[model samples]
Target chain A: MTTVPVRPPLVRSSDRIVAGVCAGLAEHLGWPVRMVRIGMAVASLAGGAGLVFYGWLWIMVPTADESAKRNARRPASPIAPAVSIAPSASMPPKHAAAVDPPLWTGAYSPGYPPGAVSTPPGGSAPAAGPGGYTPAAGPVPSVPYDAGAPSQPQEPSAVPSTGAWFRVRNMRYGKEILLGAGLLLVAAILIARLLGVEVPLGTLIPAAAILGGAAIAWMQLDETRRAGLVDKTKADQAGGWARLAAGLALVVAGVLVMVSGSGSWEQTWLALLASVAVLGGVALVLLPWGLKFWRDLETERAGRVRETERAEIAAHLHDSVLQTLALIQRRAANEHDVVRLARAQERELRGWLFRDPARDAGQLSDRIKAAAAEVEDGLGNAVDVVSVGDTAMTDRHEALVQASREAMLNASRHGGGPVSVYLEVSDGGAEVFVKDRGSGFELHAVPEDRMGVRESIIGRMKRHGGTAEINSSPDGTEVRLKLPAAAEDNGEGKS
Target chain B: MSTPALDGTAGDRGRTVRVVIVDDHAIFRSGLKTDLDPRIEVVGEAGTVERAIEVIGRTRPEVVLLDVHLPGGLGGGGREVIAGSAALRGTTKFLALSVSDAAEDVVAVIRAGARGYVTKTISGAEITDAVYRVAGGDAVFSPRLAGFVLDAFGTAPADIADDELDKLSARELEVMRLIARGYSYKEVAKELFISIKTVETHVSAVLRKLQLSSRHELTKWAAERRLL
Candidate 1:
């Protein structure tokens, strides 16, 4: 399913110096690639504004290959963002720029359009951007120019600046935003100093302290969030640790700045504040490692306790319940009631003892076994069910289970002693065979009034787009039910 | 407690079939020993993997009723016992006895060298028949074990000429289905117009394919389809 096709969707281009954001924008807007690159460089040097936009684009826009594959399957609506902004708002800025240049150049060159060499529709190539970039900027109305696209001078405020900032905040480039803000503060202070304005070290040092502490805290929070997402590569983990160390060093430097800046304060108060700052820095630095060690110890202790409890339970079961069941089976070997009761109790106890929690209760095997157990309990016939492979619970699978139950009931009713159910699930389809060894009845000879075989087993399967066949002979009767694979039933109502 | 006469008296005719019952549960072992038929004698018994290996090596019974899960010897269970008693492969056959419904465990023991697999819930008469069949150099296929073999080797390409060693023949598949449908070997022979010996031959061929064929797809299919 796709919405109205945007002729060339905005996606990150393969050709780029960094994460291909500016190249992608240039291609999308039919602007000169070099002009966009130069503009991005200028914006980045001007207090790190470009870095924020780069990180935001890296997080939001899919790469060319991703968009192409997505389009081939089901094109994402550009107007309506596919991923919600709330969960990602807490995500840390990914190190997209940390990707090596040689790998990208080698990988993306075969299928993608050449980034810098392609001429824009207005005939302004990257080489001619320095001379002819001005005329092209005025004509493009779809450009989302704001602080990020500072080179577009004609309609700088054409798009709402609030919208661009909203999208930025939505991406949640937490670390980049902090870095950009710190750069802006430094830039402002430098400009003020150049203009001979007296800048107070007292306020500056405390501000740096707050920013550094916030950066460290933000990184730690992001680490915790990402631990559950995907396993990080060793390089990614090392990079994160390095960034954390940088944040810690920044906080330490801020404390030094604070100690030097507080020359006018009383000596006792200064000593107290400095010692507190140093202790707090040490605690912050050691907290994650200490927490990790404590968690490991707790997990090991819990595992040992569980092991001991499980062994005790097994010993107790073997010593009491199992022994009693065996004794009962031997004492009343000819008594059907006592034997059946003991057998059922043993099955239950064995199941409880060695239950695998990973298998869900509603699985096909379990459902079939429950049906067989019910039939056995009701008719006093041994119903053996053996299943290979299983499918997720779907309506079609539910229908299969119902038909199997009906077949088992029929087998027990008409056919004599024991019933067997064999279920197999493969990629192609699922099939179940319920068989009984007795004098078989001819379906044609059965009166038309009997609804058990016709309605419950055959009709129900037909309604679910499956087929049911009954093979009968003097040897036995076998009911075969077959359902096609799930992929073939896409047009049907899944529920 | 005492080993039966090991003189070549166990046969398919009127002679007794010596059997060793190796299960982790002592109560079940004693119960099975009592429940066996008069023509079939329990020669030895063991509770753990190592003890089963040791007992089987010493008693050398005609058939060993092995459980799939055991407590000792690296936790490999019945497979380890079978491997440990490899020297007796020519004389002593294994019929795996399990209480659990896990197909992988059955498949593992079968692959190791068990001639057949049957659940513990079977009647004592059926177990005696299975032991006689194994002792007579015939592979036993309980309905559940037949279902497993069908699921494993039945999904190959229908053209038997392509991979005949790994794939089951159409006749073999028919026999397996009949067995899985609770047909006795005699009944299957009657239905297929073949002799009981031919039914045994087909089952033995399937068992041979299950153990000896080095088919990657077969291993993968068994691994993926059978739940642990």
Candidate 2:
């Protein structure tokens, strides 16, 4: 269904008849409102009875006064923008005033009524405001659910009608433009009347102000909504450009209008003339803040991108590389063979050092620590891997070190118990033992070809005339590796 | 078509073996391939599942050295080798060239029909001999891998033996062996067959004594000893 245009009820002007019927009708129809007023005036003069119709219509049609009541009765959509919370009275008046600019010095002051109650303060005790009076608890209004047409009451107290009036503030830009134009039109007319000058354009000023304000407000909301979806950095950059463009346009237009309106340069009013210059200066000053906001937004976006990349790398390593190695170890039956397989896998990974084809390079350290910590985490701080032989292995000796690392990696990841890594070094060689306090495997009975045993112990030791001795019973398992003295002493450290 | 007997090469040392190295990893293949000596001729190389198959099919060198793991799928290399068994029947022998010495991978490739299994870390000279040996249809496996295959084969159960027949005394076992060797009832009446009536008595005595209940067990027992 097509939507009918909905407009705010118009308020009466003072100089013109206090009746607001013409203004309301013009607002609803998108017509020249002045024309409506002139037509109504002519009608009243001709029949004199039209005044009675105006009074009846004014009483029957709803005004802005009913806006709050209508909103509270409306049904809410599940998906809607969060309501903006208004500030409390305790905030300095200056800070609160800066939040929403006023449309005019006179006319409407949109604010909470002095006696209006608020929702209970978020925390325990209630705090006093400027008046130092106890706040009342406003009654929450109940809404009627209608089967056919939905008409809602607007009020902060009514829960269902919130969405209807929620969109009202969206047109704030239009309101500001209208207020500015209206004042200008009234000023021009007053000047013409007081000076007794024939200003041929006086009649069209009010119409221009209302129409221009509506157009500007509509355009601004659309741009802001579109800008909000972009990454914060891009959004900030776009916002800067928009503000700069708007400022430049306003300054140029204001100067042109002031110059054109003056009959002669000598007759210009200096105070009003200086105000135009001030407006242009304000726009220029905003340019830098806009740029700063853009830069901050960009850095934030970059930070988020890096975080996601790191997570992706972690997942890749866990899912593919580590998992594959574990599978090989489990499938192998002999310890000697398992060691060989593990060594091969380790060597394969080392060969890809520069490229880190598996992409787990960053997360590998954490995975090792986590596997070790699993022993502590599961057993509740009962065990820990003290060190991996002083952490002083060279690239050539990495294969040997990796063997022990894999054993620790496996011991920690599997079997629930307290696990500790013990390292001993001498001129003879190095011996690293991964001991677990938990009940151990039934060796010689049901052999478990744990990859760590195969890859780390057997693989490393066999190459250097070293040997791994695993002694296990119902009590626990002690996996010990004895390395060749020559290999250990001469092994280089990893770069 | 056979490659000409490789007598010597540019840096001649001894008779060279024509070899084809197949592995999935470029770095590993390159590392291991460098070990090939002047005594070995590196004929071709393949680094993937399909490429290895194609390269081996075309080269048909003295030895089609391969790996168990290849890119297309897990154990794709082994499957390619085994499936090619029908076509490769005797044209070229497959020597599994691998960095893995896992018993499972080793046994798997052997089952998927590899002639031998060898690790990539082997020295150049040993690898050359491995290629030659496999090409000659002599099974070659890394010592550990060979043991795994041997154990797998050795664990099969043996045929049951007849307890009643085996219970026979040493003299009887020897006599049974000779009787099944082709001594007849008629010959028995003459020399070792026995005296005419005595031969009948001894035959009945032997059957009843062993409790075989039939002559089949006697025949099988003798056959087991390779006496028939």
Candidate 3:
């Protein structure tokens, strides 16, 4: 089994079919999400049921869960140092972590080649350590974790291999197309049945094949050409806006086929043919762009998740990991103990870093209860989450849950005493309240230490386009977050 | 995917520097171990604050390359490293490694008692150099960061007048003292219970109010004032 880089579930933007697997894959492989979607659509069209099979594969592919990840050992493949040029001190770390723009998006940073290393100009090299490092004199075998290379003596600075983008393959596109085409066939069959059209699998099979092929072929050819008929480097040089425009055009073509009307037996076949042509064309012309767009969306979402995870990881490190390491680093004269502590921190760090960022999007009541449990864990205080109005909440209810959790954390961390949390839905909106019996203060004078308050409650609420109100005094504080029923309104605004 | 574990560094007699890398990304850690020479070795890597500590006890790498944000904790969470018993003090060096050169993160890690601050963008070579420098009983600050440290400590001349310096809060003055002592921004934040942003604000305030242009000026003034 090919060992996929273990990552959190949500950050796996390449997974789009079931909770954004395609999006997760696109982000992971650094491809466009729209292209993945389009390609999958085309593939399903071409391969018929094969598309469905691909979707199944997506669902079955084991996503590395946090618990399993906590125990897995990361590959220590020795990486051969490439070069010894001085790294510029001014270059920010964020810039370093960001993928090479040209490789992923086709846009080039000013003065740099589309896929060149982003080294700053005239940076000073760091002072050499003890032995005054010897450079590589001969050919060095490229290994992922080879530290032994530097032990040999040579001449100039060893090549410092840094960020490298993984190449996205056409097979993935085929996989996506097949998956997409399968979905369309199923939907079409279901629609036909819903309309009370009597048809056997044998009869529908031929028609499905003909229509799916036509759709996949047409979309691929037309859209691929419109996608500028070039690869990533050349395409990115064209600009993101242009790529998006081209992708939209292909999507339009695909939509046209899905909706086009031609009812007669012969015309029905013709419509199927037309559908194939349009979808195939769309897939080819704009799928890459679409895939890229989708990937970016997923990436952004994952980035947020990653940020939160990082924050949580940071908290863990501050609270426990670093403290333990400090002890080992300072007073652990026993090499074994120090090594053990260091290893522990490393495990925790890897847990936070390598673990997936996706939250299990399950039932609403369960999720709320889970949120309550998590709050209790965080604050060491009991939390009660209640549901009002029988209608169930979906993952969409997370904003409300997060708001309540934040409020609870605030009450526990700074409200000066224990707290109670309540939730209810009324008047086309849902309300969550966190009430604490502890001493509170003026709302205007936000406590500097109250980061989680501003970030979790306020930030989450604002993102979901909701409102949070805080009422506090020396006696106690009550925090409430309200979400309008039309939360979907803001969902469409994301694009 | 179990690859062969390190052959338990055969009979290593002397102590090794325990280290942890904190960053939100894995690709950043890809070439880390190879970057540091024999003087420093990476025992583990972490993506968050909490896990970093957990692993710290397990692997016991002497230094941690701490990132500001991780999966389960805050960026400034590394304070536990500093506030811990002296047993942990000399054995580990929490060298904050992050994409955020954000003054807040820098000061925060410094106040957390991280021995050094270096951004992710630093070449594997510089990172290697940093590990060794920090290991050898010296505090390491990137040249650009040197100024922030000086400013945080308010190492300006007392003769510069109390009125001009009044713009700096008493907390800011405390930050200045720590900075002058060679603490990173992250360390400063942990020390002050302020965000890295607040720490930066203090540093900037001192720089602006005292009319001192660089860390060198602050250092000189502090030397004259006997602050260090």
How many clashes does each candidate structure show, in the order listed? 0, 29, 189
**What is the Cα-based lDDT of residue A18 in candidate 2?**
66
lDDT of 1 by residue, A1-495 (tens): 000111235688999778888888876655668977988889899899878877877897889999778656633233222111111222111211111122223333232343322211111111122322244344433222222222322222212223333443434344455566778888998999999999996868766775776668576767758675355689977887877777766775566557656564475466667777988999999999999999997798679879989999889788768776777767685676665566556656656655667676788778887888888777767777767667777788888899999999999999986787878777888888898878998999977788999999998888887899999998679899998886445665343
- For residues B99-126, what per-residue lDDT tens digits would candidate 2 score against the true structure? 5544456555655556666666555666
Q: Candidate 2: how close is chain B to the reference, as a TM-score?
A: 0.56
Share of real contacts kept by model 3?
0.00
For candidate 2, give the lDDT of residue A206: 33
Two-way TM-score contest, 1 vs 2, winner = 1
* Docking quality class, candidate 2: incorrect
Mind giving the per-residue lDDT tens digits that candidate 3 earns over A55-102?
664565445353236324432111111132112233221221221222
**Candidate 1 regions with alpha-carbon error over 4 angstroms:** A1-200, A207-247, A261-370, A373-380, A388-398, A424-430, A438-447, A462-467, A471-476, A482-495, B1-13, B157-163, B216-228
Where in model 2 is the C-alpha error above 4 Å?
A1-495, B1-14, B73-75, B101-103, B150-228
Best by DockQ: 1
Worst 10 residues of 1 chain B by lDDT: B1-10
Interface RMSD values for the candidates, listed in order? 7.3, 27.5, 24.3
**DockQ of all candidates, in order?**
0.16, 0.01, 0.01
Model 1: how far is A375 from its true place, Å? 3.7
* CA lDDT, every model vs. true structure: 0.70, 0.47, 0.51
Cα displacement (angstroms), candidate 3, residue A119, comes to: 66
